[model samples]
Target: MIKTWHLGDSRQSMVLASFDGRLPEVVYWGPALPDGESHQAIATASAADVSGGMVDRNAAVSLNPEASQTFPGHCGLSVRDKNGTPLAPAFRFQTETASEHCLTLVFADNALDLTLTFNLALEAKSSLFKLQSSLESADEIIVEWLAAPVLPVPAHADEMIEFSGRWCAEFLTRRVPFAPGARVRDNRTGRTDHAHFPGLIVCSQGTGNTSGEAYAFHYSWSGGHKMVAEELQDGRRHVQFGHASGSLPVGRTFRTAPLYATYSENGLNGAATRFQKHARNLVADGARSPRPVHYNCWEAVYFDHKLDELRSIASQAADLGAERFVLDDGWFGRRDDDTTSLGDWVIDLRKYPDGLTPLIEHVKSLGMEFGIWFEPEMINEDSDLYRSHPEWVLGPADQIRGRHQLVLDMSRQDVRSYLYEHIASVLKHHDVGYIKWDHNRVLPVVDASQTEGTYALIDRLRSDFPQVEIESCASGGGRIDFGILERTQRVWLSDSNDALERQRIQHDAALFLPACVTGSHVGPRKCHTSGRVLDIKLRSWTAAQRHMGFEMDPRELTEQEAATLRMVTGWWKANRDWMMQADILRLDSSDPAIIAEQQLAADGSRFVAFAAQMRPSDQVLPHPLRLTDLDPNAIYKITLINQDEAPALSRGAPLLKEHDLEVSGQYLMSHGLTLPWRFPETIWVLEGRRL
Candidate 1:
């Protein structure tokens, strides 16, 4: 017999589970019919004929069978018994409940004393639905594999899109054909590493940026995870995601992370918009506050920490209208470089004889909030913390270190207490308003308990120091996910601050997360990681679109460059209110060299658009770039923001100010304006207001 549960508003997204008088199997999960048609759809799908066709008798009841007798494509629960054999026990259907926005179903394997519960919930005012599963066993069970909310996609979804990248380069999109068999992507680095982000996009053939059926899934987990997209023997497809569960005992109940999934008949961009709306609802209250413009000292001073030099930089940052000042590394313990003193939280007397109080007070006196950096989850073996407590590290007797540091065994109660108290002590002593939390290395072993312990430490900090904001940085863009965003305010998108590289990185990262939660900063003329030189205007233009900040030394800027920085900073402050709350729209262009994005307010009163010419291309004279997400009938006044600044190259600027002096919203988005493409690496910033 099959039972169906639906959780949505006027339109429903249905979940179907089948039981052959014993175990319940999730058979169908996708978009449902409109209000009145849902019951008929479910009844037709759960009919006796459809129920009998799911079983395969050729390999049924065999020891090494390829599939279960009633395998639901993707198994919700797969485990081993006490005798080291796979358990295929029958589960009896239990009770189910439904609320206004949530539906939950439960099943029990009475013989093994294991119970499974699935929660299906819909976002308050969105088409998105979130699914998670939990398992509870009365006796100790050595679970081998388990996945919650296994999703079934239509067989027509032949195109698969996943993201893969390295440290400085993150979120590079990859597309492949969905063939028969399992295609698995795993992140075992104990972090949502730079290699593979915890998200996937599957679409049917001929899907463009804005116009075809698509399904997007993102796992809201920061630690080790695995995402699988497999095509079954039948014409159906399944997408599964969960934490990497190792050989751990199921003490009482183990719950899996939520896999956020959304379906859109309108295409990839439509699916992305739904995910963004859902995230806005879940964002913390502190994060929703206006993100301040910051100045970080990492690219400025590196390991050369001098009191007098930093004071001068602080004054310059204040002059440029920076609201927050951050002192990066080399202020704590014997940490002149990255090799030592990672676990030490005390201020190094050699760097500042009067401690961080003097520097913190100096920055605050300049009308800027003071923030510091910390890597509390790592320790160098040569440091005092590791020498005193050698057993606190996570690896073997002879541990192999990454980035000259070992992972602190956060699973230990003693380790948690030590980190919590020391980090809290710093916050209590100084007038610190923000923290740049850095995690530099991957875990030596994958353990879910350790991840939970880290979460506990962050929770304690938030409870104790509610006024302090934290920025999560795992090297760069490593620990980015909704799991960490729940505790912190923002994330450092990438280490490489090259303007050209950041255009792509920030563009893709903004698909699932709002621009306010992503941290983008302007680096020096020459980026440290890529060693590529970019014009200060190009860098500032790209950075201004997100949570804006400066990562370079202010004193190094020339008088002309300084004036441009000040102007850009002032513009961001005046317009950030609308920018933070605006809906992001990514535009499609025929030439890949031209990348355009728009930020339009929800009320359609104001909008900001950015277009960049990444590099020179063969198609020099491209077509007029059209805008999106604007009120077609409303009249709008458009102006060039940096018309007074010098042109990016020797070639002249586009005739934007001459030809398109004034226009209506419909004419602007439909007819569009042609931007100048004379110079390589050029950027155009346009501001629009409904008149």
Candidate 2:
């Protein structure tokens, strides 16, 4: 009559129930329930009473809501028969398979020969719930819309936070209040685009970074994704995420990407830490420890690749403590600029005259590993690859181009094969250790198959060359998501290296990304993307906040600027072993002008808090910066690492400016730290250790 399943970790539990052999619905999901709790009672308690305007019985908003069931809100599944006629088949539970951490439920519409399956699992270490759904038919059917297993939003949540951004500025959070109707975001860009990053955070009435209840959701998909957060007339709410509608073509079987969700009782940081841990420990592979000081020559030598000049830059980068040197773009085929030579993965003899060997060897001689860039998913009309295989491009010939390029139909095996051979050739012959994989343009059409094909190629290459690490850079942060991170080891967070912009971008992005996998490079004094000239101190400290690196030409640095950068790089290296594993917690700053974060070590022994004064404070006096996630009983010795950077105008004697002070965690978190004043575009670094 009634069947139920429960999946839980130490932190959270999820209970699902099938009423009268119909499709199942999530009856409970939140804090971990006691072992003796009855799931049957929970399912019964989740039922709603009938009203005058409602149907005789409340229609179940099950894992996959059906249109035939008379549901009020958005249906989870939309389908059509072979002849383009709509099919509204109500699924009934047929069978189920269960495990301690995973559960699979299969429901079938016997009359229509349609079978629907829901698979749910709890990641053991991360405590994140993963859910997905699939459809199968005895006859071919066209799937219009199919969501991953739907989950109910807590009634107490008042607002939701979704990520939105553009080139040079990524991971901007937007807060949307829940209204009566659905808040939908349909990204037809055909990539895990910058405009709509496939992640959401629903917070209770009053939630902040350090405290209050929050629920995080991310669709681990790289294709065009569709998100729907809706409220029903009955006050119930649900959220759905899957590939964009029509992304899947007519087929006998279809499936949704894994929807990763986690409940956070300890505010956004709890969810953030889980996602970060999952990304670092499970998803990403071959990430070098100590996260080598990255040096990318993109901003320095965009398309002008000269062997002797690159050797000089590499030598200077190595002197500045760069452990990895990446030759970004313009290394291949007649590639003079963005207008030509995409999809051609070959070393330009005109640039090197010999090959990449001399430059790579020169870089290695300076004690840095060699890395190269490749835009494997794009093609230029002026290139040899496009001329030879014009039919290999995705979408129509008349489709608008992005950055003078077209999408290479990753869905084609031949295309993937061609890319693999050329990309693999370089890896085979040379001692190349890393690849800066770039996707410069959006797809002409929203097709899920394109993402799948890209994954296959990456998987194949990863299988063949497990030692070589890859960094996913879609024109800088365009294609960043859990799906891409699973195959690649790192991500170029954004193209804009302006420290002021990065201060906010990195703070907001901390909701899902961790430092080790997030690449932050110090740009030129005048940022190439934003053209904002910032001091070397702000630039160096900002870069040190994450996986530290430098992208600017070392030759441009003044003697003092170079010395300051060297000092910061050395400091980063000194603490990187522990800092790389630290939890980046966003501090709730009293001053809106200040964006700060505390990187607490995994073992809770030490921390470094960075407070960047973005603008002049609204008030004359600065507010005390309170830290989070510290033991109230412990006494810590705190010191301002950059006390000397205080401006001449900052005549006030803040306790931190003079000397290190020992204070209890309660005092620090409550009354907070008092530091010397800093001008706009400057940051204060506070280091603390439990005494």
Candidate 3:
């Protein structure tokens, strides 16, 4: 017997086939197929020819590749009985469920009484595919590893782009070629660590930003994850993503997180725009519109929380058009520093004798909504909560600490209750509108339930106080994933406020995150983290590229710097409503030194291009910056918005610098714009309006 099924949106489709009532495997996944295309024929054509040394019939790389089937590559599921004896499950198709946009398949291993199920859904608008797998047994079993539904990699794809980075430098992209053996990435760090971002982009050779075919995958689990891109000896290739191996304890049922995948015919931008739209329209749908301009005090004041100093800073920030002010860290417990105050959510009497109300009121009086920081998932031995209940900590008592702190046992009901109560008390008392939810340390043990518990707590709070917003900050960009983003509204992209670093980080992160949910802030003149000093123009424009904010001490800015910053802040505010919905398109600059992107408005009526010269070009002349995703027939009036900021060294009078020039979109995209020459560390901002 043969069974075939397919699900798709307008842009792409996925077809799965099952033979002999066995588990299903994806046969075709790419551009949308014709309405009458035969899925059975596609499945038949997907088969490989048998050879002498190989088994009589090559075992299918089914959804749940089984050891019993003798499938040569990595098996999809690994489990054992309670007594440590391994159980080889042979799943046979039992039932199936289908919906308009979703499909579910069930198979059972009658001997072990084990049932394995797979759920696949295609998001209607974004055309992104979501797949997951679940397992249930009659008796308790230990699940070593259970992968999501496996899908085949296109044979034509030659290289895959994977994400990796360290603290203060996240979302670094690396390209790996598709070779003979398996290329596996196993992230064992309890949370989605900065080292692995749980995303991959597989592209055919010669694929660039604007053109060529590409496929993207993101494992949506905030906890540790494992990804495998393997090429079998016979040349068949498959990709699998799931929770890290051995992360789940012995249980009767196990389920993997949703694996988000999409196929793009228009290159990296096609996949990026889909992910960005999905994140904004679905993941962060509940977030407030006209996202408020933000000012965070971490870089400005560090752990010092003097009321008078903070009130003065709030006044300055407010005058500079900051709509919200967040008092970050050191506001609670006896926490003068990072070491002694985590997990004690109570307001520190030493820092605020009258409690947070005074500072919150002061910030509110300055016409800015108040926000405060909390590291609820972590604990310090010096904290009152930890002193009272040392047993609440996760992992072994002798386990080493991270950032001088231990992780709270989020899985425990009592622990969740305690944290909710304390955090809720503060929210109830103050007129707070935002919470900078921070996770400063990684868990000592990898437990999926811990992430579930954190989700529960955040869900409960968001349910009660729907108006309050939360920003996910795990030492910045550490715990950023779809799972965490579903609960929080914004992400602190990186802790390093250096514009030069942020320029690259933001550009790379645009693949998965939309500007509305990415918080970019202007740091001090001398970046505290990188110690790189940049001009106010570069700093201001970099922050303006996303959900703009300021983290520097407003009092430290000179008159000239303040005026320039104020002018940029005004421009951001004026354009934010539309820019929030704009698609950030990374421009293809021929010049190696220029890192540029164009934020094309959702309506395709206007766009603003930011071409930042990181260093001196190898060639003396500047390269024409080519834009993307514009109407070829339309004429656009292009003007350099920051022409006045050009340094004296830029003596040449480029047409953009002198006055506006009306040009065809074809000309702008083909021949491109010839921007005025500028010094390194400077950016050219060009505004284009369709006419």
Q: Which candidate is the best by lDDT?
A: 2
Error at 463, model 1, angstroms: 0.9
**Per-residue lDDT of 1-691 in model 3, one digit per residue for the tens?**
6899999877898999999988998888899998999998998897888997899888888887788899888889989999999988989999999999999999999999999999999988778898999999999999998999998887899899999999999999988999988999989888898989999999987888999999999999899999999998888888899998768978899999999999999989999998898888754556777888999999888998899999999999998889999999988888888889788888889879998888888888888889989888999999888889999999999998788999998999999999999999999988989999998777788888999999999999999998899999999999999998889899999998999999999999998999999999999999999989999999999999999999999999999999898999999999999999989888778887999999999999999999999999998779899999889999999999998877788888888888999999999989899988889999999999999
Would you give me the overall lDDT of model 1? 0.78
Per-prediction TM-score to the true structure, in the order listed: 0.94, 0.99, 0.99
lDDT of 2 by residue, 602-646 (tens): 999999999999999998888999999999999999999999988
Candidate 2 overall Cα lDDT vs. reference? 0.91
Q: Candidates' lDDT values, in order? A: 0.78, 0.91, 0.91
Model 2 root mean square deviation, Cα atoms: 1.1
Indicate whether candidate 1 or candidate 2 has the larger TM-score.
Answer: 2
Model 2 stretches with alpha carbons more than 4 Å out: none
Q: Write the per-residue lDDT of candidate 1 for residues 418-516, one digit (tens) a residue.
A: 999899999999998999999988888888887788899998999989899899999999998888888888889999899899999988876787777
- Clashing residue pairs found in predicted model 1: 22-91
Model 1, 204: alpha-carbon shift in Å? 2.5
